[model samples]
Target: MKRPGIVLAHGKWDKPPYAIGTLADALRAAGHPVLTPELPWSLARLYDASFHDALLILDAAAQALRRQGCDRVVLGGHSMGANAAIACARRHASADGLLVLGPGHFPDWLHQQGISTDSLARAAHAVASGEQERLTLTDVFQGRPRPVRIPPAHYLEYFAADGPAVMPDNCRHLESLPLLWAVGRADAHFDLGRGYAYALAPPHPASAYHELEADHIGTPQAATALVLAWLARTFPEPA
Candidate 1:
């Protein structure tokens, strides 16, 4: 019999079907099916439309999964997509388990370097209006890996909905839902310790934290072993 579906939300730009592919494969090998949704305005307007736009996608995905007989599920995503997945779990109270990768509250790293609220609100404006192409992701990251430029609309929508400011309160209320927060210790965009201290230990202490040595942009293959191992220990199922 197939195990419960694990809903895979990708990172940034409609959280497009990235990052979770390999993890999906792992879950599938464990007899779990996966759902990776195509978020709205992805190709052209990813940046500008990300804030309010992605919510529609999430609602739709949840409904679709229910239709396919997925009442119990897992919510998972990477980077900003990770933020969306966790929020989805919070809002819908969806999933029997929750897993987050590269999630942050306040994301001090980005703000310290200067991700202004004014700028984020502006991005929200551009997206709400559907000016996606005008968006660019040139400042999407930091360090030698090169920034992943996204359109203004996508970032705007993403910020409006899932920005660090909105995340802490939602996350704090969650208790014992088999949460796993994973990141690369070498991660540059957000520090696990400072931004996710509560997520790392007890109360919600049953949560698991794994540190991959690679930076954020590196592929899942780099840390797949640890992730799968952790998942097995934390989310075991009956045979």
Candidate 2:
């Protein structure tokens, strides 16, 4: 029998290639079918369409796996995608496991860097008043300046959604499902200590954390190996 299918959600502003494609290819080579959803977050106008929309995409992928004869599925993603995956598992009771790659504290990080929330507040008002469907902002992504135009409501929702509190909450929702969290050693985006603290704090039976040598964008090969090993230990293939 084949292993369960895996659904990967892409991070903000990312389509297929950045990091998910590499992981998907490796997982496929290891005999696990994978689906990388092109979420609303990938688009400019819909970039901040709320995690609920992203969950819909993930739900569709899981349903597709079931149609293809996969009994159960694992949910995972990179960056914002990882945030969506954990949130999906917390909201729905379908995922058998979770793989979180480089999920970091977006709001806190922005605040620390003085990213200027005054602008976000004004945009929020514009959205509430139906003045605009979206708003534009500039920030440094992957260490380079980039402009992001997104729905204001979505932007605020995501800001309130991600942080230290999310970990414990997600673990509570997950209950006993195996959860694997990985981050690179040089990842300036997320805090490794906090990741480990939360993963262990949940009292999850098999929750584990890994530190790779790569940076914010982790090593796909390392992630693939870790995921395969975890799958073998958590859900071995039947004879």
- Who wins the TM-score comparison? 2
Regions of candidate 1 where Cα sits further than 4 Å from its true position: 13-17, 40-45, 48-50, 104-113, 117-139, 142-157, 160-165, 190-202
lDDT of 2: 0.70
lDDT of 1 by residue, 1-239 (tens): 23566776666443344656777787778666677776543444444444445655665666676778765566776666666666676666666777677653243334454554555666667777877655433334433222345677545444443453255655765545777777766676445463554353224435666666766655354556665665566556656
Tens-digit lDDT track of model 2 for 64-102:
887898886999888777767877877776588888887
lDDT of each: 0.58, 0.70
Error of 1 at 230 (Å): 4.0
TM-score of model 2 vs. true structure: 0.85
Best by lDDT: 2
Q: After TM-score superposition, what is the CA distance of residue 124 in candidate 1 from its true location, in Å?
A: 7.8
Instruction: Assess candidate 1 and give its TM-score to the true structure.
Output: 0.71
